[model samples]
Target: MRLFFHTISARKKLVFLLALLVLPGGCSRHKSPRYLYGSNCGICHHGGEGMAGSVPPLSGRIDRIAATPEGRVYLASVLMNGVSGPIRAAGVPYRAEMPLFRYLSDEEAATILSWLSQQGETKPAPTITREDIAAARAHRISAGDVADMRAKLDLKHPLP
Candidate 1:
């Protein structure tokens, strides 16, 4: 090891050390909504379950919810405006304070929601689009409004 180090020029040694550092970061980088979700949402959502679960469990409910036009818009509203106060999920109640992620671009919001809807099952899920996010943004409801929306959403069953 000492002999190999001595044989290399200073520039080569620096290059080798830099490559060692950069490779792991490059390889570890997460793509698309995984990064968006993990970085922005993974903390409390814990893989998207409020446990009473992010905003409710992504385990099975997301695909069901996204199947409906109203549900899709509600979801986009939650993401853009966020919801506070108490809510029930999976039969239990949770009072998490979700913050608005309005800073995300329309494309990024669509990507995140699309990823969320696809989580935890093999069933094909509907895709959220930039247009969906944009429309939600246009409405600009408050957190209280979304909190009230939780009840009407009827998230427990898939809507026709």
Candidate 2:
């Protein structure tokens, strides 16, 4: 009887451990960053590699840009407003335009940005808050200027 009880307890512990490992963020019901990215960004970014001469790949790039003050503003503006016209993303020229994501609330935008910064990363990336998004929102830069903002910065990798 003792051995049987111990075996059951061990099995239960193993099951619980497996459960924790499987869930992306400890099994919360809230939508995951991956899910949000898939719904909102995947069609354009396409597994973060993006389509050639069109959408820019985001997985390895956003956070590096976000780390800077001016870059932060540009990134925020790009997310909030949409960019159009000729642009180079990660060194590739993309004539396609990016549409505004103004529909996303500040919180949702933060979530998306946070996710973008951490793609393919093993650990969590630095978090961007709704307040950060709000501050960028305050700038109210136009979509055209936001797209143009890219010209000012030296992007290590360009987005198409």
Candidate 3:
């Protein structure tokens, strides 16, 4: 009886461990926006401050870009499709190829964008919803096309 009880306890422990490993958002910060940003965007953006002359800063710029409907759409499109070629951000020119994050789920993408929008010096951060990401996904375009869209947006702080 003692041996049987010990075996049952061991099985219970194994099951609990497996549950923690397999359950969604369980014992894992992967679903958190900060973690997502760190693993995905942070590599280049470097805490959203960017790497001067190489990667454009996202801190102050992201909020301003998200201020308008068109800007919001552009942001969603950029996140889904990525962007390339020469572009101006924060009045500085950068020519880098941002990788497409199409693998990210709508919820994860939205969360990351929304979290990023809240970063920097801007107050009253803009929200990027899953619907926004879904809409961008519906109209699939190339990364280069996303850069073109960025040029056309009438943002408060225009991206040249």
Q: Give the per-residue lDDT digits (tens) of candidate 3, residues 1-160.
A: 5575576777787886788678866533456889888988999998888999999988877777787788889999988999998888877888969988888888888888889889745678888899999999899999899988887774444652
Q: What shift in Å separates residue 53 of candidate 1 from its native position after superposition?
A: 7.5
Backbone clashes (count) for model 3: 0
Those runs of model 1 whose alpha carbons end farther than 4 Å from true positions after fitting are: 1-30, 51-56, 155-160
Q: Between the candidate structures 1 and 3, which one is better when assessed by lDDT?
A: 3
**What is each predicted model's overall lDDT from 0 to 1?**
0.76, 0.72, 0.83
Residue-level error in angstroms, candidate 1, position 42: 0.9
- lDDT winner among the candidates? 3
lDDT-best of 2 and 3: 3
Q: Write the per-residue lDDT of candidate 1 for residues 24-96, one digit (tens) a residue.
A: 6554223557887877777667777644443556556666678878888888998999988887666656785
TM-score per candidate: 0.71, 0.70, 0.84
RMSD of each: 4.9, 8.2, 3.3
How many collisions per candidate?
Answer: 1, 7, 0
Model 3 regions lying over 4 Å from their true place: 1-5, 9-13, 24-30, 154-157
